[model samples]
Target: MPKLKVKKSAKKRYKLIGEKKFIRRKAFKGHLLEKKSPKQKRNLGNKVVVSYSDTKAIRKMLIC
Candidate 1:
């Protein structure tokens, strides 16, 4: 069989944690930060696990 290539976009977006779980950056912090509160910006800076509903699809993209 041919080598399974990983999706470049997924590689840049998601990070593999352990076995199956993946972590990603929170959204809405990309721009227009002036109106956002400190607390909101702080929370958005942290990485969050991908939603359970999307786990399977992410794994496939990662070729895990």
Candidate 2:
């Protein structure tokens, strides 16, 4: 059987913290930062765990 290929994009964007648990950068921090409050900007900088609803698809792509 052929080896299963992982999604390169997913590999780059998401990180494995543990089995079945993935972390990713939060959105809305890349642009328009000047208009957003400092608190909001600070909060956006942290990595967040993937939601349970979407975890399966991401795990499939990541081959976890």
Candidate 3:
């Protein structure tokens, strides 16, 4: 059987912590920073865990 290849894009973005947990960066941190308040920008800088519903799919793509 052929090896199952992980998605390169997901591998670069999401990271696996252990068996099930995955870490991801918060959205809105990439653009429009000029209009966002300082507090909002600060909050966006924080990394967040992926939601339970989305974790499974992300894990599959990020398998490494």
Candidate 4:
């Protein structure tokens, strides 16, 4: 059987922290920054953990 490779794109998009937790970037920070509030922009810059439901699938893609 062929070895399953971890997806490089998924590796870049999500980071494994501690053990089971995956840290990810917040969306909506790409364009039209002027229209968003300062607070909103600040909040979007933080890294957050993926939801419990998504962690299982993401783990497979990441080969964790």
Best TM-score goes to which candidate? 4
lDDT of 4 by residue, 1-64 (tens): 9999999999999998898899999999999999999999999999999999999999999887
lDDT of model 4 at residue 18? 93
TM-scores, all candidates, are 0.87, 0.87, 0.85, 0.92
> Which residue runs of candidate 4 sit more than 4 Å off their true CA positions?
none
For every model in order, what is the number of clashing pairs?
A: 0, 0, 0, 0
Candidate with best lDDT: 4
Clashing pairs in 1: none
lDDT of each: 0.93, 0.91, 0.85, 0.94
Candidate 1 TM-score to native: 0.87
TM-score of model number 2: 0.87
All candidates in order of TM-score, best leading: 4, 1, 2, 3
lDDT of 4: 0.94
Clashes of 1: 0
Error of 3 at 16 (Å): 1.2
- Which pairs of residues have clashing backbones in candidate 4? none
